[model samples]
Target chain A: MDYISRYLAWLGDGIRDWLLNADDTGHKFALMLVAIILFVVVMGAVLLAVDRPKRVPRWLVTVGFVGPALLMLTFGLVYPGLRTLWASLFDRRGQNFIGLDNYILAFTQSEFQIVLRNTALWVIVVPIAATLIGLVYAVLVDRTRFERVAKTLVFLPMAISMVGASIIWKFVYDYRAVLRNSEGDLIAQQIGLINQLLVWAGLEPQQFLLNTPFNTFFLIAVMVWIQAGFAMTVLSAAIKAIPDDIVEAATLDGLSGAKMFRYITIPSVRPALVVVVTTIAMGTLKVFDIVRTMTGGNFQTSVVANEFYRQSFVQQNAGLGAALAVILFVLVIPLVIYNIRQLRISEEIR
Target chain B: MTTTPPPVPALVTGGVGDDDAGTQSSRRGLGLDQRAAKAKKRLTSPWASLLAAVIAILWTIPTFGLLITSIRPQSDINRTGWWTFFTNPTVTGANYQEAMFGSQTNLAVYFVNSIVITLPSVVIPITLALLAAYAFAWIEFKGRNVLFVAVFALQVVPIQVTLIPLLTQYVTWGLAGSFWTVWLSHSIFALPLAIFLLHNFMKDIPPSLIEAARVDGAGHVKIFFQVLLPLLVPAIASFAIFQFLWVWNDLLVALTFAGGTRNVAPLTVRVAELSGTRGADWHLLSAGAFISMIVPVVVFLALQRYFVRGLLAGSVKG
Candidate 1:
């Protein structure tokens, strides 16, 4: 351990010296900047060349069109995915193969089960609640007096980054047990807003983010608050797409109110509903920010993404983290496939 | 089966005219009935509107608290609910001053870093996706369907799987901790969805318009810029908002590659530091959080209409 620390410090010092001394790092960095600019220039040129009379050579077009995309995916995505999968089958140091032992451990561990359950709960609750709230808001605000204003207000949370949102909510959940007045009288003041309100209502100030199951729910509320605006916009468009003539026909048949919605409205907007639900579901499956920011996945609130980060980076148990990542990939792929298929089908109908 | 012709032409025309007037009166009565129905809807379902209002308020509570905390003194914040500041009215800009200038971790510098990262991230993907979208929509090519499907399928691969391998690759390439690495990664991750969305919108352009341009010797480039790009303003604007918000808010990639390093770290990473190391400083955090939120809020508000139009444009069309 002493040797490792000494080596790391030495390496850090060496890198620092190199960085300070070398003019090439700056030059190379500048060249990279120029390359990025040239990349744009070359794309524009290729776009212009391809649009010309004879059409740029088919080979040039193909290379121009597909080269960057293929390179990016291979280097950035495919390679990483394959490497992670391979690492999952190895030991913590990634030197020896263990062949599914990590997977077995993941299944058997109580904490892993809790993570899975909490993830499932998040996937189930956040998407549904967000979609429903958004749909209802869309319906209420559709063609109303305050449509733009209401939407702008609700969508405000989406602008805040997850870390920022977490910081904001942390203060909302801020708790300090001890307090004193200038006179030095002891006061049991709860700093968190919800707890203060609880106390005001003549109840005990509860630790909202410390409790197990309820804490998970509390964390989910933050995501729902952020996502509901997205749902509202998508679902609102779907609602608007319901043809007026069909609605008028229903009214003619005296099928007013709830009956009209059941028979005509929902069926008309099924495609949008599928898109909204699946999009939210896919997002929920990889939820990391709220969990990471609020509790750091403590107190039985860890999901797969957060746990994967902890095990791989913090704990340096790369094998288990890779296994969890593989599981996440498996869960997300089917949803992506379904979403694409749905998109294609919707296009075909159009 | 033949029915007998009972009426003469004069009587048929006269009777039709009389019925038209009668129907007009009855339609007026129907209009009154519609008004009554609308009134009943408002009266009976008052709870629906009330419920929406309540939910909106509930949703805004956390953000409201943060805004209040940003204005309160650190002593007041540590000792009381932000709501207490509402009644007591002991507001101060000291936290904002401290968050901005007092700390070694300068948030303003981080904000500039975020802008530098975000602009390129938005620009690169949109530019690449525009070409790809044009090809997918208009140009005929071999294996197009398979390629599109593959790209779409790439969306399913969780980002966690790619982080380490990409990091190792960046290290080997000597690009790790560089802005280009983060920019390229953001662009790559954003590209698949961008192509899928932009292609959907591009397909909505009338085929005849492109065919006309092609016949007139307008090349793909000419048509793309002169003909198609203008029409795609709404699409580009909307996707820009999506990509901008995404890259700006992104913490994971920023953490893995550009984290904790001065001169390169983005706002998300900087804001994250406040909580972990300076956890006791609630006032500074609240102020920093608001600062971080400012750009995205402005971006959203400025481009919201385009966002809605773009979403519908992508989804509802081919």
Candidate 2:
């Protein structure tokens, strides 16, 4: 056993040294090769194990189904969750038991207050804006001639991931110093499209992403843009599900346009509207990619999720970070429960 | 809550047409007059439909800018508005070429890595969740409802809370910076939702079919493959698309588990890198965005029917 431990230690040290000194391209190629080999070996073992003549027992099959999944969840999810929860009660280095001190700091600290406030703003604003726009769009394009075209165009943003969306919008918020030609006329100053358009309209090009409250709104617009399609698709189906006879009866009673929508359509689609609001709210709680990609959490635009990453990883304050994570979890649980209940009620109605 | 009396008798009686019908028609006529009065009321109000259209157009501007930016040259991108490219029109393939071939940054490698991470990240979760969902739905077991609810409750726990512990575990297990680590992380995060969704779908499958298979010589495994699996195509496809999109577009798990190595970094991380180290290269970033979008768009368009149908099934039914 001692011999084996020494050999393993020696092998690990050798590999670490090689990794440290090796050229980047060579190391990457080597890593890819190893990954492929590992995949082949693991898959081969599984295939071989399952190929036996005697039928794999039901229990074995059950284990096979649940084992890897359980193992993964234990290590990747449950263990980490418990560890973080425990860590949250400790100090920065996770050495001393600080109890609710970190939690108190999280609520009392000014930066954390901003994060909480911004998160609330996101939850309140983005969902309402996105859902309203989506509900309206769904109603408008319900039976329109260009419904498919319009919906596909609108849904196009949903197809782009948050990272991709951020990259796309980063250019929209790009900035550059003004430049002039030899003639001293503003020859061509390029930056963000909004800034460029401002220049074109003979107004001063202002920094869009750096402004505090307005920048928060600008960021929320990105989320609203991406989520509208999701809301539209779900709500459109709910709208479609309203019985035709009820609509006809309402029409016959001379309840037309907005009145019919208010009395009939909105009530019928209330469950779906709840689902949309809660889902978007829950999604807002996990929003880190956009902040990370676009602003790197700069200019006082950071939310709890981004700050969690920054605190834990960048600043190496595990306790405070874990405290933030718990706060986010607390925020999300109610929305998730509400969503689940809404789903259950909808299902029961169906 | 106000408890209104059930209107079943009123509904039934309202169907009869007689002397009351004349009164009802007159009332309806009065309502029509009121609607006309409301129309007059709305003539002076804001055009809500026009406002909606304006909002939709406003929402699309960023995307329009991205499309134009992808086609323009870096010089032009740095020099003028993307809108100006419509008038000047000096498009270049340099950004696309660089993104695909990797001049300074090897984005193509990250794209391939994304495929590696996503395919299994999608397939493994769906496969495992299908079996688990089948068990939860059909197989009589102790603690089934408790287990299902537990899994469902797991969705509420933020992934950030688990990141550090997961990272430490991966390092301890010697799985850090490996493809397996990312795949495993994604599958773990994705499984609760997948199982929840699939269980809902599987519960809707008629029980008689499973009993009929049991009446024959079929075992659970055989029944799962021959009968239940084929019937689960729509559910599987829907879950597959959701999982695929989640994995493909994932940045957090990939960033944490795969580390910063170019070989392991997915397209999301690669695109993120373009902003920091390659900030001035908006042209490359835009083209990279388009390239990364191609797979998801194709996946969505190809399976859009299944996607829509599955959402309806998952949401409306269970």
lDDT of 2 by residue, A107-184 (tens): 898988888888889989988998998888777655443456566667767767898888777777777766678986
For candidate 2, the TM-score of chain A alone versus the native chain A is 0.84
- What alpha-carbon RMSD in Å does predicted model 2 have with respect to the real structure? 8.6
lDDT of 2 by residue, B76-182 (tens): 88777787776899878888888789667667777778877787777677776876777777766556677767776776678888999888887887768877678
lDDT of 1 by residue, A1-350 (tens): 99999999999988654432222334434544564686789777766665544746765665566666767877788888999999999999899999999999888899899999999999889888998888777767654445556776787776678898788777767665645689964486887787777767876666778876899998998888888876776766566556556777888999855676678767776766677777788888888888887888988899999999999889999899899999998887777667656666665565
| Runs in model 1 lying further than 4 Å from the true structure | A1-36, A42-56, A178-186, A245-268, A341-350, B1-40, B309-318
